[model samples]
Target: AQSVTQLDSQVPVFEEAPVELRCNYSSSVSVYLFWYVQYPNQGLQLLLKYLSGSTLVKGINGFEAEFNKSQTSFHLRKPSVHISDTAEYFCAVEVSTNAGKSTFGDGTTLTVKP
Candidate 1:
């Protein structure tokens, strides 16, 4: 079984400020990590992912996350944020097994104010 945990329920930041969203996962075997963003009244979109190879992975909208295998962490970060960046972010983990099972965190609401 795999599970995801988002450390923060909400993060409030002013426009242009840097932000980091912490995420951790637990799994007995290898797993793929992902980050998704959901804007107001919109569907979820993939922000970044960590499947294999490099620990650092980049995604849409200037977002990036590093996979720390030892710590079982995949924290998302951005150098700067804008009002448009305000959205709900979710962390998920997928096991390589064919059971087609995956888990998502409760989500982190990022509020970017001007």
Candidate 2:
């Protein structure tokens, strides 16, 4: 089984500041990592993923993550963040196989203030 852990339950950042969301996973076999964001009352949207190929993966909303197999970590980062970026972020993991289902972290609430 695969599981995800988000180091921080909440992150506070000022507008235009850089931010990083820590994500770690545990799996016996190769797995896929994903970062998702959910706005208030909105559905979760994929931010980034690491399935194969390059260890570094980029996704929507200026977010990027590096897949570290040795560390079993896939940390999400954005050089600059906007007020609109305030939302709940989740780290998820699934086995590499198509039959795998994602296991999500508790989620990190990103609050951007002026």
Candidate 3:
């Protein structure tokens, strides 16, 4: 049994400021973690993943997240954001291998002010 919950559905911040999007999940077995970003009217792109190794994983556009086993969370963080960064973000999880079952959170809309 696995499920993902995105605490915040929307976040508004000014450009160059830092932000964090909170996420949590529940699964009985091991799994793969992923954060994807979708720009306005665009598709999603892989921002990062936690297949193995370090808990702290860095991703594109200066984004990063930490996999906290205890909390069952993988919250995304960005130090400084650009207006260009305004988009929808999703936290997703799947089985650890080639097995194909993906579940996405409703999504978090990030609004970056100019």
Candidate 3, superposed: residue stretches over 4 Å from native: none
Candidate 1 on 33-87: residue-level lDDT in tens? 9999999999999998999999999999999999999999999999999999999
lDDT of 3 at 77: 99
Residues 1-114 of candidate 3: C-alpha lDDT, one tens digit per residue = 578999999999999999999999988888789999999889999999988789999999899999999999999999999999999999999976537789898899999998
Error of 3 at 21 (Å): 0.4
TM-score of each: 0.97, 0.96, 0.96
Measured over all alpha carbons after superposition, the RMSD of each candidate to the real structure, in angstroms, is 0.8, 1.1, 1.3
Residue range with the least summed lDDT across 10 consecutive positions in model 2:
93-102
RMSD of 3: 1.3
lDDT of 2 at 45: 92
Ranking by lDDT: 1, 2, 3
Q: Rate the local accuracy (lDDT) of all candidates.
A: 0.95, 0.93, 0.93
lDDT for predicted candidate 1 compared with the true structure: 0.95
